[model samples]
Structure formats: structure tokens, C-alpha cells
Target: MTGIVTLTAAGAIDATYRVGALRRGTFTRAERYTREVSGKGVNVSAALAAGGADTAAVVVLGADDVRFARGGLTAPLLRIVEVPGSTRVNTSIIDAEGATTKVNAPTPPLSPEAWDATLSALRDELGTRPQPWLVISGSLPELAGTGTPVDLAAVRAAAREHGARVAVDTSGGALDALLADPTGIDLLTPNAEELSAAVGRPLRTLGDVVTAAREIVARGVTTVLASLGADGLVVVTADRAVFARAQAPSVANTAGAGDAALAGFLLGLTRGPAATAAGADPLAVAAASAAEWGAHAVAHASTIVAGPPHGIRALVETSPDLDRVLTAEGEA
Candidate 1:
């Protein structure tokens, strides 16, 4: 089955430490730890593949692939493109209160040829097996020869040629390119801070988020899923907006929660039409699933999303936790 294809520009070994209390200027011993082959796009692929979604992960790594290979980080398909430096280790300190502090190492700059090879590999994948979603994720590596970033426009254009909808989960310079022209992206996932940075304003209220998302709609982008951390997520489309929340049983690791949300939303979209409409737009049902999947992710000690959430669709479609936002004051 043709399914989601994710490209992670900067992939890493996620090293997450669970600590009792994170104190400033003191040594905090980790109570437990876990590691996985992860990047935003990789995490999405892992979630989808774990749930039996036919998925592929395109990742850029250094020559050494053994680190990622050793951890049983098996997805349906994994495409690795060698770059200049070693795979960075992203460390996260998860305190008992669910607060997380992450230290992400910078990926070494890639040569021009490396970028070309990466893009070419993705284009070939798009042509060989077309899928509904082509996800371009994570931050851009610094270009060695010049400051010109990786050509996301080229990537999106390639996906369009193969008749695949594009979904992007990137920020900083990478997102700035989309804000300039978001013509073909079907879904854009960004947290509150990333959205605020993209629009050059603070999204303090639901009204502010709605307004910002609408502006992107004006640019021809189809959907926006803005994660509000513990407050849940706000999903905006051309027709309407909705807010959905799912309280976690226990918050163990908050690192990959947003990736889980994006994966769930996309998975729900492919799960077929809802038996009954819960709100104005069908995207609301997907958003509800996104919220629930995110909650399940945080309840686990692992940063990589696990198996299929069998009852997520039924629960989200029937539960009272999801609400369509008619007015700006809509907060779930």
C-alpha cells in the first residue's frame, strides 16, 4: 500500500533521561532512560509504521548508520543519505513534573552535492511509489558553500509532480520559505512559538491563533494544526476551526507529542470517512485523533511513538472533549 513518505533533513539519536527533579546548578541523576532513531519526520514514520501504516522514512546521516540500526528502530522502509558529519545526539531531561529541557546539537554543514543527492533520492521515491502525503520535516542544515538553504520549493514541486499532497513540520529558515509562498502544502504543523515566529506576532489568545491561521489560508495552504502544549491543539482549515484536548493519564515524555499528533491526524485522514460527523469539517475528527494520540505519546517513557491506538478514532469521534470553534473565544 502506498502511504506517507517522510523526509527528515536532520536525523538524530534521541537520548531522553527521566529525572525526579530538575534543579538549577545541581546534579540531577536520571531515574531511567531511552533512546531511538528520531527526527520529527522519522518519528512520524515510526508512529505510522508501528500502527501498520505503509510508511517510509528518508533520513540524512553521517557514514555511521550502526547507532540508529542497533536500537531496533524498524519502520517499513528507511532510506539513509550520507552527509558530512556524525549523527547528532539530541538529549532531553524529563523531570517528574513533565517539564522537559532539550539540548540539540547542530548538524555539520552539508556540501552542495549532498543536498542534491538527498533531493534526488526523495524525488525518485515520489516517482516510484506515489503516496498521499510527502512530509518534509526538521530543521535545515547549514549550507557549506553558501547560505542558501535546502530547496524546499523544489521538494514540494517534485511531490506535486507525482500527485502527492505535502505536509511540512519545520521552523526557522525552513518555515520562512513556506510563509513566503505556501501554495501546495496540504497541512502545516507548528507549535504556538513556531507559529508566532512565522507570523511575527504573539498568539496569546484563540482569536490570535485563528487570525494567524486564516492569513495562511489566504496563501492557499489547506490546513494548519497548531499545538498548544498541554492546552491541546487548534486546527484551522478553509471552512472552519476546531479545538480539541485529551488529558494524558501520566506525562512521562513530552518530546515527540507533536509528531504523534501529526501522525495521528494524517493516519485518521486515511482511515476513511467518519461514520457520523462531529463538527462542521471532517478535519475536526482528524484533529481530535491528533489530540488523543499526542496524549498517548506523553504517557510513554519512549520518545518514539509506539503501536496503533486501536480506539482513538471511535473515542475522538464520540467523546465530548472535541469542540468546533465558532467564535474566537473557543478554547478547549
Candidate 2:
């Protein structure tokens, strides 16, 4: 089906612990615990699938851990490629105040041969549909001997070959490389911090964000969907911008909210014609959906969403107040 296909170059076994409080250099007791197979692309695919979208995740796992990762995820939704060592483990700690502290282990670069296998798997999956949306999310690993990042350009090339659109959600050097020449990127989802980092300045107001997003839009990216925490989300393009926020829910965990938001955005875009027929701009529809789905994700303690979202209402503004101050992440 021509829906969404995701690539998770660095996958992990996620371990979450809920504690009353975290004390540095001291023992802490956890009140709850859960674990699952997780990666940014995995989370996006899972959320989209739960929301009834045809989605699949291409995950690279170690030979020893592939079985365990497979056991936790739906079989049809996964395309696993095996490497040599064990898969990395990431730990998350949520406190009583709903704050999340995450410790992610470093992933060693895949060998050139293994990297080729990963690309082959990606090509195989993309070949299944004429023009699927290919999402490459999460941290990227380097190539072993070269110490160079995985060939993102090659991935973009493959997507182009299959006439697929691309959405990227990664950070640091990998993100810089993509933005350096965003020729094939149709969409980019960067949270507040990532957006700040991209522009090399702090964004304290709605206008600041719009300016930064426009800079990237001018660089060839079609759309920039930025998450602003409590301030909500903003979608910016070359000619228009929209801001959307849903009624707040009691936030239990914010770990996977962005991934869920990206899933919703893709779903909305995939079904854009229906939204357009209803007299709404497809961009605004997507922003509203993203806000609602992100709200739904924050209400849960895990990255997995078992069902469709409910009880969430979004307010989208076509002409958002540019002067409005943003307080999320202490921006202002």
C-alpha cells in the first residue's frame, strides 16, 4: 500500500521505569516498569498502524536480539535486517511530576557491507508501493571503517527512484547534512530545541520560529512541522504558516509524543484530499491532527498507543499571533 514506510537505522530495546523521585547517587524505587522494542521510526510506524494507516518500519537489529525485538512488535509491520552485535538498550525514567529522563546508549557504526544490506532492505520496502512516504527517523549510525555517516543522499536517491516523498526527523550532524541540501525532503519535524539548534539561535517567540522554519523552506524543504511543547505545534511553508494546539491533557509521559505527532501529520497528508474537500487547507488539517495525536501520546506512559485517540480537540490558527511569547522549554 502507498502509505508510510519508516527506516530506523539505530533501533533499541526501551526500558522504562516509573519512580516517585530520582535522587542522584542514591537508590530509587520504581513504582512501575515497562519495556518494548522502540526506535523513532518504530514508534512512528506503530502509531500510524494503530491509527489504521498502512505502515511498516524497516529496523536494523543485531543477530542475537532480532528474535526478542520481533516478539514485542507486530510481525507484518516489521522488516528486520540483522547485523553482528547485540541491539542497544535505552533507559527512561519518569518521575511523579511527569518529567522524563532518558539515557540512550551509543550505537556503533554498521559495517559497509551491513550498511548496504540496510539500504537493500529499504529499497525492497519502497518497491512495494509506487509513491509511499518514506520516513527516515531517529539517530543515524556511522559507517565503521570510514567513520562517515550513513549515506543519507543514497537513501534520498532511492526514494526518488521510486517516486516517493521523504520525511526526516533526526538531529545533530545527520540533520545538518540533510538540511544542507534538502532536495528530496518533503517534510521535517523538529521540536523546539532542535529548531533552535538548526538556526544557531534561541527562539523565544512565534515569529522567531517562523523565521527559522522559513530559512529551511527557502533551502528547498517543502514544509517544517515544529513541535513547541506546551506552546503546541507550528507548520510553516514558503507561503503560509499555521499554528495548532489541542486542549491539554494530564501529561503522564512526553517521550514519544513527537513521534506520535509525526504519525498523525503523515496520516493527515495521506488523506489530504478528504480534508480539502471539506473546505480546509490540507496543512491546517494536518497541524490539528498532529496536535490531537501528540496530546493523546502525552497522556500515556509508554511509547505504544493501543487505540485511536479520543477526547482531544485542536484549535488551529491560520494567522497565528507572531508576537506571542513561547514559554515551553524556557524559551522566554
Candidate 3:
């Protein structure tokens, strides 16, 4: 239960410009900021490490842009694979009120050799050590080809070969392809829209989500965690189904909420009795923990202004009232 590996994108930064105030068509003032390492995988890894898990992040970083992405990482193991080309930087602008406008730079594609090397590294890591649970999340770099999902499937195969489980948190074509032939995924975590898109239908209620989850599980997934934002989460397994609700907090930023949920749920799954017991309703427990953790993570993350990225220190410090809501009846 201790070994866990997360595969993701990585890069250094360039510069971000924030423009405030707009009169007619021109900006009144513009502010420039230096770049930093930012991506979905890094954020999820940070959350996992903050939650006291022995987590390692495997990502590709630009040759020169190393400090920005690798800096501030306190994870027990942070492995960076050097790649050519400067990493991408994204820009954002907000008016005096709070309206935001963002422009994102393009991410370079990983070379075929780089991709092969990454998979090889993953295989070697899993092969040598204890069976490490794999969390494959985030979008592939734009340049990485259409075979990204297939490549991920190969990674899943290797993990399974070594007696590990995988949680896939991605969308679009990759997700569709994976669902078409889900062979190694233990958990599928997607939001409502992504779930609807994957199932090729509209999901408007908890019942629709449950139906969709049943269909996906029928295809091949062992479990489904469909996040419904304010409506909370709906979790479905082969033998049990449950929905965990939370009182919504004031949301400042929604960037890493799902990542937080994934980390929290996985934390529960790996550490708690959820995985070992037959017909155990760990999904309800995991979903509750995920919702509570996500709400608090978003609250704390939104408070940080341009300084260092907010770690999970605050979220870890605060405990949500999960016990009051997740009684035996809730799961039943």
C-alpha cells in the first residue's frame, strides 16, 4: 500500500503578464511576473505529498527551465527528465473587480525517444520496488501524438503486470479511447461533463450519473467516481453505490480541486480497509473525504496572491465533519 507513482507533465516558466483596468479597448496598466512551474500533475503530487504520502512525480522538464518547475517541491522523491525546448508559460489578466482573462502558451511535444524513456523508467521503477499504485492524470503535451492513450494503456499493463492499480483522470479523445478498451484502470475519476461526453449522452441528475457509472463499469472499469461539483460526488462500484454531499464553500479558484479529491480518495483507498474488504462501501468514505478535502484546498489556494504556490499545509490542518454525514445509512 505504500508504493505510489504519478506520471505527469513538467516544465519551467518564462513570464506571465497581468493587465488590470481596461478603458474602452486599451489596458490602463500592465503587470509582468516571472514564470513558475505549474501543471495538473505537479499540483496533484503536491497535494499527495502534503497529505504525508510517499509520492514521486515523473515529468519532463525543459533543459534550461529546471528551477521554476522543480523548485518548492518537498515531495520525498521528485524525478525530472530533461527535455529540449523551453517550457511553456501562461498569462492571466484580471480587472479591478475579479473578472479574469487568460492566455496559455503551447506545450511542446515529447519526442518519441523521450516518451519511450518515460515508459521505460516507469516500468523499471515499478519492477524493482514494491507494487506501486499509479495515478495517471492530466492532458498530454499538445505535441505528443494521438497515441497518448495507447501509450498510457501500455503503462497500465506494466503496472498490472507488477501487481499495481491505476486511476485515470483525463478526458476527451484519450478518455474515450481508454473507455473503449479499458483493461487496466481500477478507478475512473471524471467530472459530470467529462462523464457525459464519454458516455455519449447528457447526465443531468444523480440517477443519470449512476446510470452512466454503471455503463462505464460494465465496459471494464472496476469503480467510478463522478464529481458533481456543488452537488457533491456520486460513487459507484460493482456492489455498492453512494453519494456524498458537502456544504459548498466560497470558491476563489477551482484549479486543483479535482486533484485534491483524487489524492484524498486514493489516500483513503490505500491506507484504509476499503480495498481489502469484500462489498465494503469505501467509495462513500473516499468520496466524503475527497469532497471535504477539495472544499478546503480550494479555499486556501484562492487566498495566495502571486507568492509561492499554496501547499496542502492548511488543508491538512483543518478536518472536515465527515463523520456526521457519512453514517451507515448514508452508504446503504
Top of the candidates by lDDT: 2
Off by over 4 Å in 2: 328-332
Provide the TM-score for each candidate, comma-separated: 0.88, 0.97, 0.78
User: 210, model 1: CA deviation in Å?
Assistant: 1.2
- TM-score between model 1 and native: 0.88
Show where candidate 3 strays beyond 4 Å.
9-35, 74-76, 90-104, 142-150, 274-281, 302-332
Q: Distance (Å) between predicted and true CA of 172, model 1?
A: 1.2
Residue 147 of model 2, lDDT score: 78
Query: lDDT ranking from best to worst?
Result: 2, 1, 3
- Looking at candidate 2, the ten consecutive residues that score lowest on lDDT are 323-332
Which residue pairs collide in model 3, if any? Answer: none
Candidates ranked by TM-score, best first? 2, 1, 3
For each predicted model, how many residue pairs clash, with residues at least 3 apart or on different chains?
0, 0, 0
Q: For residue 195, what is the lDDT in candidate 1?
A: 84
Q: What is the lDDT of residue 220 in candidate 3?
A: 83
* Residue-level error in angstroms, candidate 2, position 252: 1.4
